[model samples]
Target chain A: MLLMIPGPVHLHERIQLAMAKPMIGHRTKDFSEILEYCTEMLKKLFGTKHDVFIISGSGTAGMEAAIACFSKVKRITCIDNGKFGDRLGKIAERYTEVDVVRFEWGKSIELDEVEKSLAEGSEALAFVHNETSTGILNPARELAKIAKKYDALVIMDGITSVGGDYVAMDEWGVDVAIVGSQKCIGAPPGLCAVAVNDRAWEFYNEKCPFYLDLKAYKKKLEDWQTPYTPAVSLFFALQEALKIIEEEGLENRIRRHRELSAFVRKWVEEAGLELFPELNEYSQYSNTVTAIKMPEGITDKELRGELKEKYGILISGGQEHLKGKIFRIGTMGNVTIRDVVTTLACIERILVKRGIIKPVLGEIEA
Target chain B: MLLMIPGPVHLHERIQLAMAKPMIGHRTKDFSEILEYCTEMLKKLFGTKHDVFIISGSGTAGMEAAIACFSKVKRITCIDNGKFGDRLGKIAERYTEVDVVRFEWGKSIELDEVEKSLAEGSEALAFVHNETSTGILNPARELAKIAKKYDALVIMDGITSVGGDYVAMDEWGVDVAIVGSQKCIGAPPGLCAVAVNDRAWEFYNEKCPFYLDLKAYKKKLEDWQTPYTPAVSLFFALQEALKIIEEEGLENRIRRHRELSAFVRKWVEEAGLELFPELNEYSQYSNTVTAIKMPEGITDKELRGELKEKYGILISGGQEHLKGKIFRIGTMGNVTIRDVVTTLACIERILVKRGIIKPVLGEIEA
Candidate 1:
């Protein structure tokens, strides 16, 4: 089955079978051994030597923890480009005083705007490395550099970027990088992993809620345990997925993503449908799935339904104002060139059949 | 390895193999189908037609959500018989304006006190059926009846009781029953399953926080979906565990627990160790692991550490004020009579070596 949605991607059978197995006690020496090994492996995946803590919650939970832990920072600057960016601002606002710098939907966040926002002497800046909603990827490293100039901590929402892209957590000057299992990790959701730099640990120790407190997670992770009952089954799958990632090599994994994204981009151009995202310095991982702005009379949901119901392809529909106007196809994690080609071919057939795009004879490569 | 802890028993290769499988999409039709069936099966396990909603969190998450959703309650009465009961009170205090009825750490909750507390006017009375921390099980049915008399809702913390004893949800008039997958359900600890009666639903709809909102969970559960990326792996593990419970028959499972608990009780008596809990009203599932009150200079932790390190057998020490004052061994789950006998023998050896208790004269039953 084609799984082109932003998350809950098609997983390998190893992960599936792992979920069906018996569980070990979290406090047992055996589970701790696995937890210790998995933590070390994830640190390698995150490109951090500091520490990787796993929490049994969604990505939002991790975000909440990050925001809550830095309460000493009186003002948190949130870079709002799309849906996820707006959510970060909203969550930060709930717990801490936050200032949001907004941008138009489907637009890449300008580094200059962030630079100007940081001029206010805010405590830190929060930005989404990959905005899954509009397929816009911010230049996180550049933003991190700008934030560093102001001596501010940079929190990157690398939820969709980490494994699919070259995040370079330690090399990028990113203080805190948050990622989820469901996205590029190619595992099920429910496990949110956050890597805290030495500096961020200081922030965490001083300011945070009890549960979202980073220091608490760190202390627990040191013992190779979680503060709560973790998603052990998910942990098993991640161990396997990370092993596969290691075998492929991080650079090779990123290269595969780039190849698949480029293939997807080629098809969109051939279809002559305008790409929704302004792809200036966008995410290489997802390549920012394009919204096919069809002929004026075409119905967006109908096309999506045709592909999903008839062809059994599950593509993501647009959110909010972009609803029924855009359909996104993710290109990440175990998705090969062949998978991309077939999916695009099916999509092209659906478009031509719907009379939205003129059928070009043998334009699609099988 | 000897695992006599309350949960996370020594898993068979089959259950461990089940957990090793990969994850599936939570929203996709495939995951929804599996989730739907799991929900139905859980309803059967709980002996209720009430809607079952699964959250990807620890059993405490279920308790928090239950408290969070029942936001309209003017006062929730938390009955504390032991450590777990006290923990429930602590959690309820976070969301609901709670009224707590206290009992001594190892003492049983008096039905008269509970009935009197209900008369004081509370919207809900929350109690832990099996207080694993102190191994004291409250009379849930009688409390449920008394709570119903005050026009109050009944929420039972069945984290250690649901799968081990008789939990007649509808028959016992329980409005909300919270369960953890790790205990009697015989799965890993990720998802929390809750059964909410209609009256509880009304309260849930009135003022629940959006994320912990039971109404939201109910909507998703109906369609076999979840609010967030579920602990996909644990869900399937739970599915298999529930199937085992069904095949064995609920009565047979409960009887096994009772027999095991009785066997452990007999061994403790033969060893001349004093039981910590009220024997008149014991948890049929887990006989309160007694505090030997150690002879002279011996500490519980020192003895427990030696037993674990020497024999690779793990037992639990007491919590809070009771820590290092008492030791606990839980008899429940897929554990057999042989395991009970083996654990008692291990304890006997540990006690004799430490000069805390005299070595047994007769051999234990296999």
Candidate 2:
């Protein structure tokens, strides 16, 4: 079975086997060494000199942790263009006065609008680097520059972009960057990684819940440990996954993902499907996922059901307002060109069965 | 290495293998089935008819979630006797007005004292069923009865006791009980399980943090789903761990833990060591772990180092005030009589080498 969800894409066998290592005491020297080693690799993958920590949670946990610890400002600006972006805004609203700069779900973030919002004198600006809900990669670097001009700390939700795309937290001056283990890391789900720079540490809030407190995490990091017992198996998987990423080289990995995403997009167009996000000079499609409008007269449920039940291929349907209107295919993690081609073939077969399009003579094999 | 920590106990190979399962989309039917099956097994293990949900976090996350969702009352009483107990009280202090009933560490909870506190009209009584810090199993049934008499809801931290000891949440009128995956459940750390009874749901607060909201969890439960993406691999490990528990039978499993704890205590006595807790008829020692006073002239660091470096055995030292005064041995989660005996043998060997104890004749196999 193939899993092509926006996250938890697909794990390599090596990373999966790492989960089978025997349990070690979280306080033991062996685990300490492992924690240190994993932290180093994570720092490299994040392309940051800031401190990196592995949190035992999904991507949302990292987002909440960031909000819980750093949103002490009087007013924070959140750019919402997709589900994840809206989620960041909602979480931020709970802790501070939030100014939400909204955009269409499938549209790119307008730098001019964000610059205007930052001009309102906010302490922090939170945005999603890659909006998986609509397959749009926002211009995080440019937005961070505008935020820095206003002296606002930049917080990014890089869950699907960090590994698949070029996300340099330090380079972009992102104060806090959150990534998940299951997306492009090729690790199992259950671990969230966050890199926090010194600037972000200034806003630490002790009033935050202890479990999600960044200060507590920072203190524990001194001893190469976490405040709580993490999912040790997931940590092991992450370590192995990071090694794979290092061997592949981040640049090569980004290029591979770009090629795969482009290949998938080309297939979608040939199959008479349209990309959900509008393509323009400023619009950058996410390398990790591709959102496509459903063919006419075909419901998302029927298409995804047939893809799963008949072909053992699992893709994701639209979420929130876009539900049943579009579907998403993830080509992140260990996915290859063959996997994408096969998925496209399966979708074409299902579409043909539904009489949505005529098969190309050369594309259809005997 | 042998892991004899209070939690994150050694996992069985079968449970470890389950963590190696391929990634599945959280929305897939396969995942829904796994969720339903695992939830059912967890209910059986928890011995409660209440709703059980798997949270992707350490046990502390479950504690915070319970406090966030169920602490809408005017006042809640937290019975603080050990480190974990005090933690619960501290977390409760953050959510609502809290009345703390304090007791000495390594001491039992006096029901009369709790009754007096509950008389002040608390909406809920929060305490730890088993205090891992001091290896004391509080009288959960009696306390629950007293809380019920005052019409106060009962919230229990069963992190280290749920599967190792008898935890009849419904039978004892426990409204909410939190357990971790790495303790007697014999799964890796990362996932936390919470059993929430219908009565506790009445106090649900919308102001609670959305990520930790129980209402959202329940809404997703209708379709055997989590509101956010969960640690899927940990869920697989948990399913296998629960199956192992079912096969062993909870009664037999509890008895095994009791026997292992007893064996370790006997060895400590023979080695001229003393139990940390004051033993009396009212004093119920935890079946899952045992705390022993450090031998005279032997520092915890020295003793633990030798045990770990030479014998590859790992035990835990005390926390906070008890640090350097006592050490703990865990006898839960896939641990057998043989493992206990081996650990005891290693300790005896270390003591003999340090000239703290004379070697027993013929006791050494060599």
Candidate 3:
């Protein structure tokens, strides 16, 4: 079976085996070594000299941790262009005063608009670098530059892009970059790694909730431990997945993801389906997930159902307002060229059955 | 290797295998079923008809979730006896007006003293049923009764007790009981299960942190989902562990734990070591973790190191104030009589080698 959803993608075989490793006490010397090794590997993947802390939860937990711990300013500006971007705004609203810069669901965050919002006097700005909902990659470096010009800290959600796309937290001047284990890391879900720079730590609030406090995480990291019990098996899995990434080299892995994304996008165009994000001068498609407009006659349920039931392949549907109007195919994690080809073949067969496309050269028989 | 720590215990073979199960999309029908099935199993294990939700973190996360979501009243009473109880108090203090009822470590909460404290008017009462630091089981049923008499809600930290000790949440009038996966459930560490009654839900606050909010958890639970991405592999491991518990029957499993505790206590007495908790009319020993008074001749580092290096066994030392004074042995999770016997044998050898105890006839030979 092929798992092609946005996250919790099919894990590599080594990661699965690593999950079965014997349990160790969280305070033992063995665990301390594993924690140190994993932290070093994560720092390399994040392309940052800043500290990285692993929280034992999903990506949202990482997002919340950033908001809860880093939003110490009087006002926070959140750029909302898609579902994940909107989520950032909502989470920031819970902790501090938020100025939401809203955009259409399928569009990218315009640089001029984001700069204008930041110019309105904000202490920190939060945004999603890669919007998973609309399959659009926001201009992270440009936005971070603008935020820095205003002397405002930048919080970037790189959950879907950190391991798959190019994310340089320090180089981009991102105060905090949030990442998840199950996306491009090819590990199981449950761990969220946040790359935090010195600027963010300088503003750390002592009043932050204890469970989500970054200062506590920093203190525990000094001891090579977490403040609370972490997902031990998931840590083992993440270590193995990072080892695989190191062996393959980070640049080559990013290139492999780009190749897979290009292959999927090309196939979609050849099949006469429209890509959701407009390929314009300002727009950049995500290298992890590709959103495609559903054909007029094919419903999301029908297309996804046929693919899942007949071919054992799973894809994602549009979330929130765009539901049923668009479908998404994830190309990140352990997904290979073969998996993408198989998914495209399944889509072609489903489209043919729905009378949206015609089979060519004995395609129906095959 | 014997994993006799407080958590991340030696999981059963089936649970370990479940951790290796293939990944699935969290929004898929397959995940919905697994979520629903695991919730039901958790409710049964919690001995409650209340709603149960699993958060992808450690027991500390569950503790904070309860404090963050349920402490919206005028004043909360936190019983602070040991490290974990004081932690509850500290978390409560962060969110609401907390009246900490302090007690000495390794001593039970006197019912009269608790009643006197509750007479001062409180909206809620929070305490740990099993104090991992002191290895004492408080009088949960009676203390909950006193809290209910004052029309205050009861929040229980059942992290180390749920699956090993008998925990009748509904019978004890507990509004919320927090449990962890790696303790008595014999699963990997990642998930925290919270059982909440209707009364607790009535007080759910909109001001609660988004990631730890109960209302969002409830909304997602209705559709058999979580508000945030959960640790999916950990859920699979928990389900398998719960299945093992169901097969053994909760009563039988509780009884097994009791027998293990008895065995360990008898062995400790024979070896001339002292139990940490004083057995009195109001005091009860925990069936999960047993704290033993460290002898004068041995240091925590020396004793634990020798055991781990020579015999591949892992136990726990006390936390904070009790760090060097007491050592702990966990009798919970998938630990068996053979494991206990082996640990005892290893301890005997180490003690004799350190001149803390003398070897008997055939002891050295064996």
**Residue pairs in candidate 3 whose N, alpha carbon or C atoms collide under 3 angstroms:** none
Off by over 4 Å in 3: A358-366, B358-366
Ranked candidates (lDDT, high to low): 3, 2, 1
Candidate 2 residues A141-199, lDDT tens each?
89889999999989999999988888888988899999998998888888898899999
Candidate 1 chain A least-lDDT 10 residues: A282-291
Best by lDDT: 3
Error of 3 at A96 (Å): 0.7
lDDT of 2 by residue, B1-366 (tens): 888888898889999899888888888678898899888888877779879988899999999888878988989999888999999988887678999999889877877888888998888999999899999989888889999998888899999999888889999888999999899988889999889999997788666665777787889999989988999999998889888998999899998998888877777666677888864455588899999999887799899989999898899999999999999999888898778878888888878888887655224321
Model 2 residue A344 lDDT score? 82
> Native contacts retained per candidate?
0.53, 0.83, 0.87
Query: Candidate 1 on A1-366: residue-level lDDT in tens?
Result: 567777877777766666655555577667787678777877876778887777777787677666667646778899988888988897677556788999887877777778887898777999898888887667887888899999888888888888887788898898888888878877777778888888885555242333355676778777777766676777777777787787888889887776777766666677677767775663332452434444455667676677777877677878778887777888766666766766777777877876767764256543
Interface RMSD of each: 3.6, 1.0, 1.0
What's model 2's overall lDDT?
0.86
Between candidates 2 and 3, name the one with more favorable TM-score.
3
Residues A284-347, candidate 3, lDDT per residue (tens digit)? Answer: 9999999999999978989998898989999999999999989999988878888887888888
Q: TM-score (0 to 1) of chain B, per candidate? A: 0.92, 0.96, 0.96
Prediction 1 global C-alpha lDDT? 0.73
Off by over 4 Å in 2: A353-355, A358-366, B279-281, B358-366
In order of TM-score, best first, we have 3, 2, 1
Top candidate by DockQ: 3
Per-chain TM-score of chain A in candidate 3 equals 0.96
Q: Give all candidates' CA lDDT scores.
A: 0.73, 0.86, 0.87
